[model samples]
Target: MILWFTIVQIAVACAAGLFCLIAGLIGRRPSDYTVGSLLLVELLLLAQVVIGIVAPLTGNPPTGDLLEFWVYLIAAVLLPIGGIAWALLERGRWSTVVLGVVAISLAIMLWRMQVIWTVQVA
Candidate 1:
């Protein structure tokens, strides 16, 4: 919900998404770079979870629908986990692409979360 951190998350997610997408398109399978990028995004999302908790306690509570924000945040966290699982199980270039798509989807979701946190009013 922090604006600057949300921007950072969006940037990182986009970069990771594009990186995985390019790697997949060039006939690459899931590798450390591709998988690690997703892990990095996951870490960021986890950090966001902590921030989401602490931020409200620190008096930066969201002005929007609290339940909607939480749902988006939870979904954002789950997305990368699912993508990584798919990549590991499938072990194919398309799996890498799926990871890319997941990352991109996560970026969009994060953006929506930001809106829900700051723009929408309960």
Candidate 2:
């Protein structure tokens, strides 16, 4: 994993989470802006996944438990995905709330991933 990119990802997730949380708490429904931001986050995760795969091939494998790191990566990608579906189904401020929570969780998961990557070398 690229440390710099991971840091940027965390920042993006946190910022997005705050945006969603505020929108949700203010009684606002989902909007294109929020949805677009969510999509951006998804795209970034996809990029991270690619980088993760390539990093190992290039001899930069994590020093930690690989399976655990993989699990975190999968969850980080999936949580927001599930939240997006739920938001679409629910169609209200609660949808944004779910997204907000997902974003926050994703950030934490990514941070853990960073730690795992750095601590456990191949």
Which predicted model would earn the best lDDT?
1
lDDT of 1 by residue, 1-122 (tens): 78999999999999999999999998899999999999999999999999999999999999898898889999899999999999999999999899899999999999999898888778
**Residue pairs whose backbone atoms clash in candidate 1:** none
lDDT of 2 by residue, 2-83 (tens): 9999999999999889999999999988888777677778889999999989999999888999899999998888887888
Off by over 4 Å in 1: none
Give the range where candidate 1 is weakest over 10 consecutive residues by summed lDDT: 113-122
TM-score of candidate 1 on Cα atoms, chains taken together = 0.97
lDDT of each: 0.93, 0.89
RMSD (Å) per prediction: 0.7, 1.2
**Model 2: per-residue Cα lDDT at residue 37:** 75
